[model samples]
Target: MLRGLATINFYADDVEAAKDWYAELLGVEPYFEGPGEGGTTAYYEFRIGDHQTELGLIDRRYAPPGLPAAPGGAIGHWHVDDVRGTLDRLLAMGAAPYTPLTEYGSGFVTASVTDPFGNVLGIMYNEHYLEMLGLR
Candidate 1:
């Protein structure tokens, strides 16, 4: 049984870079880092968005074998006010374009990017999402 999305973990060969990149994108630094004592930062977490969703970066060194080298499969698209602007900003931040912004009809616009670390980050401007959040 799933309650809700508590966290989304992405693997990166360089956790620090991942942290910095995400910080720049989210406009906030990581709220948590471990395991302390001058330990190499193997993990970093940032609380972001209206819901304060957790976005985590884990060192790929600890990644279990068989994980894909590049991020793929199911994508979780975060709601945004400007899909085109966000995608452009991500690209300017060095994220390669994953999916060009496209309309899914009925006012649903979606796009995605492959972070330097190979994680796919998606953004969407959804009419239904705004209605559900009572924001529209």
Candidate 2:
């Protein structure tokens, strides 16, 4: 049975750069780093946002076989109060636009940006999410 989101992993050619870039964007440092197969750090993790959802970065060399090098897939969007503002901030931080801000009716809005590491970072302002979190 499926539960809540555990971790969203992003592949990067340089794990350290990805960690530093996400640290600046999220305003927090990675809480965990992997010793990897040979004692080199090949992975890093950060627990972020209200639910402490995990965001991870793994070295591309460790990526599974058949994984595409291009950035495109099912993005897991995080809830935010200001989708546009968050998108703007990410863009200012050198993130490329993946999905422009769009209203989804009934007060729902969503957007996304592609990080320098080629991962899509999704953002959304959802009333349903706030209600579920008891934040409404």
Candidate 3:
């Protein structure tokens, strides 16, 4: 019943920093920046990867009430051409490695890193995803 991963949202205490950081990593500026209180940027959105998926960055002040400061909960892995390369780039960009590259066998490999904003960003190389893309 699920269509698939669409817009993935991350919250940052400093949206501007997050915007710039993500822009650099994605190799493109955000297609949209939402205005916030005090004329600050509250949100940034970038369409990235082969699918042009929407990756959103919102000011942490807008996060749901009672959300814990610690990074936990769900980690959604975005498909990438090279998990190891992507992980290396993320680490070089100051992102701490949350999980090292792991071969899951059967053409599945995955890894994750914690972004500067304290969000768990996962990357994966999935054969099924590539097959679907080829079908399209």
Candidate 4:
């Protein structure tokens, strides 16, 4: 069982540049830097509020094979207190929903959307029953 979304890892061509861009976008600098392998490559992380969910920047050159190229934005779904309200705010800020909300099963709702930069985002919430099942 998990508490919530932990972190999102992104590959970047230039780690420093990507970190700077995300720092500006998120309005928060990295709070922690991982230990590099011989000071060569490492990850940069920023926290989301008080949660463990983080935005991570990783080195593209050192990434495993079969993974997408560097500087490629990754899609991540985030749960909010109010999906409609959050959608409205994001829309006003230039985000667009790719798909309308739909019910997956008992007490589960999901929607697909895209940020201004083209990164896909999913929004979802669990019903009380699902929460009781520890799926939230």
Candidate 5:
């Protein structure tokens, strides 16, 4: 049975840059750095959001074969207060827009972007999510 999200792992060819970029975006440095080949950092993990969800960046060198060279996969959208502003910020940060802001009505809006590291990052304004957390 599926529980809640434990971690979201993104593969990047430059894990160090990924680490720095994510830290800049999330406003917190990774709490864990895993050493990889040649004594370089192969992994970085950050705890974020109200739930302190785990977000991980792994070196692409360790990625299994058959991985897509482009961003195309299931997206997990993180809840945000301002979808439009976040999308704008992500675009300003050099992330290419993958999905334009869309309104699904009833207080549901979504957007997504492909990070410079070729990973899709989604953001959403979900009414249900906020209501469940007593934030609506």
Candidate 6:
């Protein structure tokens, strides 16, 4: 099950600049900076309410195979009350299902979707995840 949005991860070309931009946009400072090997390449996290979203900056060569090559808009992430139920609701709402809900671990389930606007959104749920948001 889900309670509220936990986080929205963003892939960025420049982590520092992106952090600054998001800090201004979200009106919050970075609460956690991930470990880096003394270089520009590293992961950064910013908190919005109880959610801690991450921004990963890595070399293009190491980027995932299917992830978007560029950034600028939301790479969707949604929290759900029930992963299966929410997926069905989204389908009824005109969202075409792209992936079926699959359990990962600890009561977590994840699935993907293509919004009407053609943006990819990931939906997820877990009791522990909800607890992390203080929603349990």
Worst 10 residues of 4 by lDDT: 68-77
Query: TM-score: which candidate is best?
Result: 5
What lDDT score is found at residue 133 in candidate 6? 71
Candidate 5 vs candidate 6: the lDDT winner is 5
What is candidate 3's local distance difference test score? 0.91
lDDT of 1 by residue, 59-125 (tens): 9887888999967888889999999999989999999988889998998999999999999999999
TM-scores for every candidate against the unseen true structure: 0.92, 0.95, 0.95, 0.53, 0.97, 0.44
Candidate 6 Cα outliers beyond 4 Å, as residue runs: 1-76
| Backbone clashes (count) for model 5 | 0
Candidate no. 2 TM-score: 0.95
Q: Cα deviation in Å at residue 98, candidate 6? A: 1.3
Of 3 and 5, the candidate ranking higher by lDDT: 5
Task: Give per-residue CA lDDT, model 6, range 1-136, as digits (tens).
Answer: 8864555555555666656655653477777776556555466566543444443333333446887653324435456777887777667765577777888878778887664434455778767768877878
**Model 3 lDDT per residue over 25-98, tens place:** 98999999898899888999999877888999999999999978878789899988888889999999999988
Question: lDDT by residue for model 4 over 1-136, one digit each (tens)?
Answer: 9766678776666777767766764578899887666775478998874355787777766667887432234445566657777667666666667878777787567666655544456666657634655666
Error of 2 at 106 (Å): 1.2
Residue pairs with backbone atoms closer than 3 Å in model 6 (clashes): none
lDDT of 2 by residue, 82-124 (tens): 9988998999999999988999898799999899999988999
Say which prediction, candidate 5 or candidate 6, comes out ahead on TM-score: 5
Candidate 2: lDDT of 62? 92
Q: Is candidate 1 or candidate 3 better by lDDT?
A: 3
Q: Is candidate 1 or candidate 2 better by TM-score?
A: 2
Cα error, residue 57 of model 2, in Å, equals 0.6
Could you give candidate 5's per-residue lDDT for residues 47-89 as a string of tens digits? 9998899999999998889999899989999999999999999
Count clashes in each candidate, considering only residues at least 3 apart in sequence or on different chains: 0, 0, 0, 1, 0, 0
For this target, which candidate reaches the highest lDDT against the unseen true structure?
5
CA-lDDT, candidates in order: 0.89, 0.92, 0.91, 0.66, 0.95, 0.60
